[model samples]
Target: MSVQGTPDELVEILRETVVSLVRRDGPDLSARQLGVFLTVYLGEGPHTVRGLAEALNIGKPAITRALDRLEEFKLARRKINPADRRSVHVQRTTRGAALLREISVTMAEAANPQRTAGTPTGSQQGLKP
Candidate 1:
């Protein structure tokens, strides 16, 4: 089903998602790390460090650091491109996919009141029209 909501409704959904994420056990990811991770996971794969840096408009070193963190968390990994030994391809990990799925579930729960437990409806969620 297509997800449709106003800006305010989306904001409330995001707020609930964040709260749910906070309650879940995991290390807090920095904005940059999260950005890099999402870009790698959500976009076209077999991504290279240079391509990622370019896509993010960020420095290669910065992307490397983000990749390092993601690797530490078992989220993403890089491997040498067999075609071009000099370059590496960023690969998605099962752990990363699981985390992404969890986030998606959280977002879905927040959006669907029937699925959410004890969640307020409409303006009760403290969102202004």
Candidate 2:
């Protein structure tokens, strides 16, 4: 489902969503790591380090570092491809799926505060008075 809002509204939603994530007790991912995790989980894979680097327009080492953090958190895993021993495939984990769900719920709540029980109203969430 597509969320339609004015640019400022969208920014507020993003800000609120991020702030919620920051407040939660869980693995806090960097922007790059989040991007990598989303790409691996949300996109069709057999995602590889080389493929991720190319897709994200980053270097392999950066991808490796991101993957290392993801693996450390058990959000994603790297497996030596049986078909290509030289390549490693990035795999999604249950923890990663749970994180995705959290993000989705947070974004939804941010977009529609009144729909969420105990959430502040839009005006209280940085909407201009």
In terms of lDDT, which candidate is strongest?
A: 2
Worst 10 residues of 1 by lDDT: 120-129
Query: What TM-score does candidate 2 reach?
Result: 0.87
lDDT of each: 0.85, 0.88
**TM-score: which candidate is best?**
2
Model 2 alpha-carbon drift over 4 Å, by segment:
116-129
- Expressed as tens digits, the lDDT of each residue in 74-125 for candidate 2 is 9999899999899888999999999999998888877784665586645777
Angstrom error of the Cα, residue 68, model 1: value is 0.8
* Residue-pair clash count for candidate 1: 0
TM-score for each model: 0.81, 0.87
Model 1 residue runs over 4 Å out of place are: 1-3, 115-129
How many steric overlaps does candidate 2 have? 0
